[model samples]
Target: MSDMANNDLEKYAKALDNAIMKYHGLKMEEVNDTMRHLWNKTYQGTDIDGIKIRSDVEGGASKRSYNYRVVMTKDQVEMDMRGRCSAGQKMLASIIIRLALSDSFGQNCGILALDEPTNALDVENIDALAESLVDIINERKNHSNFQLIIITHDENFLRKLGQAEVMEYYWRVSRDSRQKSVIERQRFR
Candidate 1:
């Protein structure tokens, strides 16, 4: 189209990129701090201090795309998480990332849901996760609209989680003889 229009589009694109970069930078900082605090003993000899983002911006103006490589350090050794990490490590990292994302953007939505968060985690890691989630729940318990919904089949985990904040009951979902879904609220004693 016109040169003026092109220039305006370029400016808008740059602005968008700047906003995204700023948000990512802040989110990464939060992730780093949280990872440090939530490091689990089950993670083996490696302590994940933090994660750095290696991002490249490409393409023109409105068509720009950002390529990112999440660089994680294990015991001071730098490596890409996709390259080498156990299932439990990966799961914990995934949870940390989601928590960071929620902290960054969940204010507007005010709801966070976790499905099988304890899956693939060791006993120590499960305990750590339960404590971490309890801390989060306590932090958000005062918020009028904020809600954390956890879905899992681990009864022990539920008990561990409920010990801190009693919800009185939890919903049990099952199937009837006709295969219809049934949701019943069962109290925790």
Candidate 2:
């Protein structure tokens, strides 16, 4: 399966945003600003906060290649540097989803399934990610609708989240070729 399907981007991003806001006690506007800043710095000119995004790709038979240009806020952000630029776009998509969720259904939503949220993030970004997740849980505490199942191999990262009160359950999974993955749940005290 894809790292993240396009359809699910909005949902995931919203969850992420809510998590961040809840943990930090930040306003929705602050979350948006932070997300936009991260996206701009990482993509180096890409404007994900803008209203629309447009892309174009070019290639040939002898040599396969592409030229991607994203137009947002009436500004043209072009990437002709080297490799596939889709990765950056995907990251941006993830951020966008988080922002959208926090802006809309943050109060009503209860559960979130996050698969390797820090896969492409740097050290700083990872720290930010942790803070964001914690914030979401805290913000939704009164509603008690927030539950998170985060799948990752990063022990340290998991530890950070485990510190939160809302993280009530933990599960470990082991897989063998002959059998399906087995899940063991550990209740947090």
Candidate 3:
């Protein structure tokens, strides 16, 4: 990786850590330490299963080439996410990544969306996710005009949101017996 690319990745990682710390009350370094534990595998190969990877060139006047993948020593580990993560973990990871990476691109991404966040989650995990979501929204509420759009069919998840003071809008979407969709929007404190 070139200096610029590495810098960008580090910036994103830092932003992710900071967001987790602010919203979840986690220390960035400690969260990084936890993620270190999560990465259990490492490799020093030019390609993944014989597929070639792009290389970066560097030198003063004459350029030299090196493979970005040809180095590994406990720096990071790959997350076999689909295989290892539970449904709720995957859901939460997706939301957290989306929120964190968005800031890496845009300064103030006003809107963050999640589709069917309660999908595949048990009742307990669903409530835990709702609590985390509440914390995230509360943390961002005072910063600027931010929005959290959660599209879920679970009535229990809605209930976990409690009254609506923390919510700017409560969108209740449903469908008739004919399968026609309807959307209703209401304001909340």
lDDT of 1 by residue, 102-130 (tens): 77667778798889988988898888788
Candidate 1: deviation at residue 5, Å?
9.7
Off by over 4 Å in 3: 1-79, 176-180, 186-189
Better of 1 and 2 by TM-score: 1
**Could you tell which candidate, 1 or 3, scores higher by TM-score?**
1
Rate residue 21 of model 2 by lDDT. 42
| By lDDT: ranked, best first | 1, 2, 3
CA RMSD of each candidate after superposition: 3.6, 15.3, 12.7
lDDT for each candidate structure:
0.75, 0.57, 0.54
Give the local distance difference test score of model 1: 0.75
Which tens-of-lDDT digit does each residue in 1-189 have in candidate 3?
Answer: 599999998799778756753653333333333322222221112222111112343553223344332111222444234355455555554554454444443446678788987887767666666776776667688877677778877778887775535775687778989999988886653
Model 2 misplacement above 4 A: 1-89, 92-96, 102-107, 164-166, 176-180, 187-189
Best-performing candidate as measured by TM-score: 1
User: Where does candidate 1 stray beyond 4 Å?
Assistant: 1-20, 39-47, 51-54, 59-63, 177-179
Flag clash pairs in model 3: none
Backbone atom clashes (below 3 Å) for every candidate = 0, 12, 0
* Backbone clashes in model 1, listed as residue pairs: none
